[model samples]
Target: MQTISKNITTLLLLSVVFSFGGCKKFLSVTPSTQSVNPVTIKDFQEILNSDSLSRTQFFPLDLMTDDVALTDNQFNTGDNFYRRIYTWDALIWNPAQIDFMYNYSYAKILQMNVILSRIDAAKKDALNTPQTKNLIVSQALTNRAWYYLQLVNTYGAAYDVSTSKTDPGVPLVLTPDAYALPARASVEQVYGSIISDLKKAAANTDMPSKGIDIIHPGKAAVYGLLARTYLYKGDYESASLFADSALTQESRLLDLTQNPYMPNQLQDLNTNPEVLLGRISSDEGFFKTYSNTFVIGGSLLDSLGGFSTADKRFSNRFSTSRFSPGVYKQNQLNAQTMVFDNSVAVPEIMLIKAECLARKGDFSAAGDLLDKLRSSRIINYSPSGRTYTADNILSYVIGERRRELCFHGGLRLFDLKRFNKGTPFRQSILRTSYSGTNYAELLPGSVLYLLPLSAYVLAANPNILQNPR
Candidate 1:
């Protein structure tokens, strides 16, 4: 794996001579085949169309959340790298290893910058007109916004209006130039850039009304991204509005009731109506490989509830591990079963809208929306039968969010960080090693919530400041 040092080297090289279509492996600096710099709209589109652009550039963060537990033998003898992450280690990376999340996110950001820097000057053919340019720009902007959002949430403090202005975020690298080492922008600035990009992307009406495919961003995808971004920023009203906008354009939730016990029913993004924009970890089988050693946490399992005709998410998505008999693990993530889609999707947007409604004292409306979503996932679900009191409605929504969204993207970690900023959802996560000899706890206000920059990253960029540990 190439570290930030190699990324910097790659960038310096690309600055001198632009190339493409080399290095099939993740983080390969040199392309095996080199093409000239993009001088046409088609070239820009080709760069954006690469599947690697949509792939999550980091190790999955689900290991760090409370939703996973370590098995006895594996925790004791398995990979130390994952164990370090599972225990929320202050420094998870060795000196020489690459920080995949940090480096690859910036790598994709560099690609976006390349397109944004010269799209206007590129030759426009009969088919690739100004509207085509707008569409390409929209996709690039949305991609950059999403990457920055992920980087800031992982490296910087959780967004707080009071402290965001000063809270250090990841470096705001905008141009294709890679020689200058930029300092971390504030969390507020990072968020501001994300929102600006999404809004700009959304305003480009020449783009398709809905995403052309799950891989590309369209108007609905832009709205969904904006909704989630605002939700992370703690702007409920905007979140609700944008989510509504997105759902209106494309709100096709999968009926989990139809295939309750099927192992891989929702694997195809083209057929999956709910996925607005699909993305997976670069190593898509990470979960499946890890399942031999990790099991679903007791609390998360309890929230999912026992086998029932009412709810099918647990039955369809999880099962006892064949590698470790009698232990339960999520069976439907990764390439073997159902590929997990971590990007903007219909169900998540619905959940966002429901949460916003509940937070705004519209419990009835929120309950209705939640029940509507539950009905699709749960057979014979009755809204009247659900005992959702106004007092516990928000908790119910959050609990459902946990059950539905766990192990997808790094959302659980993101939720924990943001929820800790308030009272109702603030929690102290406690876990012990398989040997029960060592324990790790993450308190609501702990500095450990903010991950430290890898030693490699710090070494590569002298101006970058590490997060407080």
Candidate 2:
């Protein structure tokens, strides 16, 4: 158990002061002063809406996976931090290498905890109406759940029903007491907390129907997050139901064909029709380095299928890298600096529904859903010659997920962890060396899937255990 005072100190030092130029509506109410503690619902809402705290990056996870390939020159010039992650080396033991994500995630969680603890005091002070209080509580709960999910998935083992009870998860801190000390909880406990929070959020009907700003979590975003959580848990039925609910609430997919390219303007979080919940990564500049170092994997490019050139996703989302002539870099976001999209979008919900249906043996239903998504992403996509049977439906759905969400937010790694559970679906991840002569492989049940905790965390808390190297 680490003292919460230490945690608070670390959080304050690492917190980024986010500017809200694009999200004026959501944060229209200005705070009195930073010196004053947040006691009003509006103040808390602004905290939740801060993209600086909420937006996160899992760039190391992307490097660990197979979707990215580094050029020889780029690899040699890259820092030891990234190289260590790419090779899954013991060098990652240094807190400096991975502390940004650890600190950033916990900082947001700490804010949520503070808001939750103070909401009652705010209510007593008549700082909020019933509706505003309920909304505040709901938003804080969901936001906390989201941060915990990110922490658990990165630090703990993949959620397996049989093993989750014993799997070491990140510490669960639910209060704002800076002096309180808490120990790590099991993976099962972490997920239980997440589900409980989401359920409470779902019951808060007073919450705004949609986010005044995309960065803030709304009703549809809650459903989408629930769907993602269940999908990771392998609860396909619940995942499907939640995905459908989310789609019904807000189903908007941008027609990429109509406007194939937006070089200077990559992510339109303010007006993007497809984004249900918009959150960018703190490492917005890392995208430029990532593009300089890595290119799309050959196998990943091949999986795009016959309409690769014709598909708007292919034509609009990628371009030849100036850094490496033979390499193609992801261009979905900023052309110069990549801004990773951590939002819940229409395509993800559709894929979740498709996957759940396939898992339930509803091949036709799943195919129909896949086609609907495909039609939107690909120009003139039709089902006339395509066939998706039960035997291959799951494969198709998985392929679509991979193609649709390659470098979105380490989603490929997450999916790999979930799908690697069963013997039939289990697969290995292999990455070749710079020369392509040697390969590093991560087996289905490899401990490497669970990232090692930052050395600072272990040093501060003797009770905390590090993931096996």
Candidate 3:
């Protein structure tokens, strides 16, 4: 079936498994019509292998960021929910319409929950032993934790250590009961659970360093998720440690200078050795669709342009050919086929390490790390001779982060949100519409950055309150 359920309750009631499909309605669950009850280890593996789960992360959420801009025509005629998100509207969806972002995320969570709930009792044989069950549990936990991170970052406030305990996060549904109407957990609680799940996954030494495919979460992927989680929580030291641990397992970077292929290594997950885990769009011709609707924002294009022509990413990852004369759009989000790679790649982990070092006031080390990454993507890249100070190092890394991770997985938005939590890292974004006359500015403290809970969800479950407008 194409859809799981109509709302969160239905999502809890059913498990969705399928070839990739549209995100039109992925929110609900109905056992009678769409559920696949897992009774065997092989069955659980099949559920985990479904492409639908990979497509459930923040791929579409990029539409809301400063890096993308809608044409005036598309702004008025495109997906209504996306149009609202583009302008930071207080409400992006009506009570009747499905919030695919919310639905798809919880849909994956539901399947993970289903597996976790059933895997223990699943039949074991020669190939499926107790160790196999442990590995399966670990993968499910890791996948669940990853999806929760996406949910909390999108639906909750930017994580502040001082306030996360009180900030409302998305619901923490850990069971397979379709009738469960879990209340929103505190951001702290959600993060706590995420860390706990990832830690458990990492503890399972029996798991492979890498999986059979990128879609599966291996030890490296588990560690990568941990690093990303700790980074979001502003625990830079922990982030750096886990990032290092992850790189120890998988550190290959796709050298843009050496790859002469038309699409390059970054476009295909299978070809990229750097990818620790793979999550992707629905192979739904997303870029082709985006080309018709949006252009890369001028400011981002300018930032990409400022990097020297030696920088292969700027040339290979983007193009003006998709749009009119001067308008540019990202080209490497996916290959000619579809499927955009949203995996936690080595570059992102490297960037994480670099940012952590900069935060520790080790500018020289941070710059060296940053330069190492730049050298891989840019030919004949010389290390910066400019002396670095605490004043500029983090900002420099942040800029590099925007360039390196932009449009990858709604990451720029996440970076912006986290930076706004406090201090010199705080940023403000002014979003100008396709028509320059209208503008919406998101300050460091603006509630506009936080997406509200889906109205349909609120109407269906009274326990779940909406985020502050």
lDDT per residue (tens digit) for residues 76-194 in model 1: 66555677777778767878887778877887788788789988888758756878889989999999998998899988888999999999998998887657698999999999999
- For candidate 3, the C-alpha RMSD (Å) to the true structure equals 5.6
- lDDT of candidate 2 over 253-363, digit per residue (tens): 777767663332223565677777776653444445555535666677677653235576665545644544324444444455544566677889999999999988899
lDDT of 3 by residue, 1-469 (tens): 3244544545435634222242222222111123355578777766666545565445456766778776776665666655677778887777787677788777777778878887777776665787888888998999899888988998888789899999999899897666668899999999999999999999997899997776677999999999999999999999999999998998888888887322223225667788787766532434454544356677777766643356666665445453363233333543443333577778999899988999889998898878888888878777755567887899889978887887676788888888776667686666665557666766787887888877788887899988777
Alpha-carbon runs more than 4 Å astray in model 2: 1-36, 93-98, 123-127, 261-267, 282-293, 306-308, 321-336, 433-435
Stretches of candidate 3 off by over 4 Å are 1-12, 15-35, 76-79, 260-267, 282-293, 306-308, 321-339, 384-386, 433-436
Leading candidate by lDDT: 1
- Go through the candidates in order and give each one's C-alpha lDDT: 0.75, 0.72, 0.73
Provide the lDDT at 429 for model 3.
62
Q: Provide the lowest-lDDT 10-residue window in model 1.
A: 25-34
Residue pairs in candidate 2 whose N, alpha carbon or C atoms collide under 3 angstroms = 5-178
Q: Candidate 3: deviation at residue 347, Å?
A: 0.6
How many residue pairs collide in each prediction? 2, 1, 6
For each candidate, give its TM-score against the true structure. Answer: 0.88, 0.88, 0.86
